[model samples]
Target: MITKKQIDNNTLSDEEIVKRIVNGESYLYEHLMRKFNLRLFRISMSIINDEMEADDVMQTAYINAYMQLSNFQHKSSFSTWLTRILINESLLHKKRKLKQTQLLAAQTDNEYSNDNPLRRLMNKELKVILEKAVSTLPEKYRLVFVMREIEEMSVNETMEILNLGESNVKVRLNRAKEMLRSELSIYYKTNEVFEFNLIRCDRVVNFVMNKINKES
Candidate 1:
């Protein structure tokens, strides 16, 4: 019974959207997905470091959030709730990937190589260099760096999403910035990192909606 007007209303906050979805207007969940899709994808990519795997993790996280919509308690913003879910899924995926790589005896390379077409392209742009620099950070620092710097999330939001104290969030963010400073002296735009393809966004929306429809 959701209407186009309801979905299109700019004044509708995320909490209101969640309420509508949980109240059985499930078709409106697409609005929530579209709202957080890019941010969640960046979070996934920050952990997984592979485009395809990140996309899978993003989709899985969205599915998990959708299935658990009824249990949402409104303790935090919907974005924070969704982000924690994404972090958990990404960590699990990373663990499984590590085990698989170990089983297959895959060689790990420490040096960045020009063999990767993407890496080659990154070499050509200052903006990509900034992204590559951020990606090179250790996992712990990188997460804080992306949430704080790249995504421009507030410290309070990042701390809540990561379950860290204020001091811990500040320390990690500072360390991440210091690490990047040694490599690049100038600021560059951040929107280019892990750029979400529009076609892929539509695909995820359609896939999730279709799955939800079938289940209902």
Candidate 2:
């Protein structure tokens, strides 16, 4: 398990952390979890369309990745590799969720608390506002937008993650920006929509760490 001091000490590059973790320093995996939580959450939300379900997908992805960390070949950045795992898990979860939705009447409830303040003006409510707008986008463009604009990953990484060519990634990103340009212009203050806050961050880290610890 990661100690308190180790959690705040993230001076290592992700590749170094992975190498060490694979060499038996498994507690270091916590650093990777905290570092990529927000990115995974945002991308998962773009695909999954539900925060809670996105969190669930993220947990499964982390656990699966940890169990298979030895297979990472360093062909891509660790973030890209982990993100690919998250994307696959999210897509599979979405398919299963879609079937369940068809059989069961979907009901939505408003229960997200807005206690965090972004720049003293953009609260969680505003974040939700932008999320709803972004969620309205088609999945292909939504994924492109979240990875390119929101998460700020490089085009090459996004292309590899989405299994698209550079041209296709560029085109989809441009189309996504044009579609959301007018709608998101006013919501500029709240650029970060699907933020993975610390509370939820700890919950996910603890869940994954505990699961891996038990299995180890």
Candidate 3:
């Protein structure tokens, strides 16, 4: 009932794609996953602050979204609904990771500083530092920052996804920028940060497709 041209050319709206997928064109789901992979990864990274964990969260979120696709009511755009699901998954995963970290701390003789994950970058290129700067933002501001600035979404879209009022979204975004040191502003490029490269996209798409197919 589907053809390669439809997938390759992306001729359908997201809502149209979702409607078909729910009606038995399940393979069409790959299109949706590949489309939002980058956006979802960055949003999840804003909260998880760890690349590996962010990928893991994104994977789980995609699976959860697919399984619950029938319940989607078209109240919001597909991206907004998917984003809400990702945010919830990210928050739950962060809470669980924190609990695990705290338990490990209690079991050991060492003190805990509650620091963000630290790594020794071989070189502090603008791209690398920009990523570090965003990753280090407090969770509240970080989510708003990614949705508004990096994703270049409108105020209403960001507000809907984040459940924030228009003024609150603006305030949080401004605050997120302020938290980044002045020096970092000299070299700005959001796309360079949290990139989900081609190979990564293929792996995720293949993985999600395989899981969804098994359900059919």
Candidate 4:
């Protein structure tokens, strides 16, 4: 049995490790799990809002990924492929749970406590105001916003993942940004400068490349 300790010290690129697993070296897969578990958990959390369900979704995602590894084409990065699997697993879990709830999966606050600094302000009312501002967004706009802003998926990647046209993606993104700006303008009540940053594809690619190097 592969232990968490061993997973932490694993040494193999995703391609090499996946090949090993496909060749019946299943133990090597523990490294892949370790490498991606946190991210999968976060994505699951975003979709489901429950930690336990997110945990289950993460487990199921890895199982599915392993089963489908043979079909993984190297056209896109392995992380992107794995992320698609994770998102699918998460949405499936969400859909199943929504059968018992009145809420939509995309509208829930599935993020951790530290996700936004505005939430940690001393004024509870201000926090609620911020939540209400975000919560009032239409599901479509919110989904695109969270995927783009929080997950940092590229426009092209998000369009591919959601099977949306470029124009539709742009429209949704523009509407989301406009809504946020409108809300923040009201919240700030002045021309206060806000420092917001976005994660670009190059940074993400470089980070994943470094991880691959360290693993191998």
- The per-prediction CA RMSD against the true structure, in angstroms, equals 20.1, 20.9, 20.2, 19.6
lDDT of every model, 2 decimals: 0.86, 0.85, 0.86, 0.80
Q: Per-residue CA lDDT of candidate 1, range 65-107, in tens?
A: 9999889999999899999999999999999989988866643
| RMSD in Å for model 2 | 20.9
Clashes of 3: 0
Regions of candidate 1 where Cα sits further than 4 Å from its true position: 1-3, 106-216
What is the lDDT for 122 in model 4? 37
Give per-candidate clash totals.
0, 0, 0, 0
Q: Rank the candidates by TM-score, best first.
A: 3, 1, 2, 4
Model 2 residue 122 distance off true place after TM-score fit, in angstroms: 49
Best by TM-score: 3
lDDT of 4 by residue, 1-216 (tens): 676665534465788777777888788877778888888888889888899889988888888888899998888877899999999988887877777564544334434335755555635776687678778789999888888877899999989989998899889989988997788677664444443335456777889999999999
Off by over 4 Å in 2: 1-9, 104-216
Query: Candidate 2 has what TM-score?
Result: 0.45
RMSD of 4: 19.6
Tell me the lDDT of candidate 3: 0.86
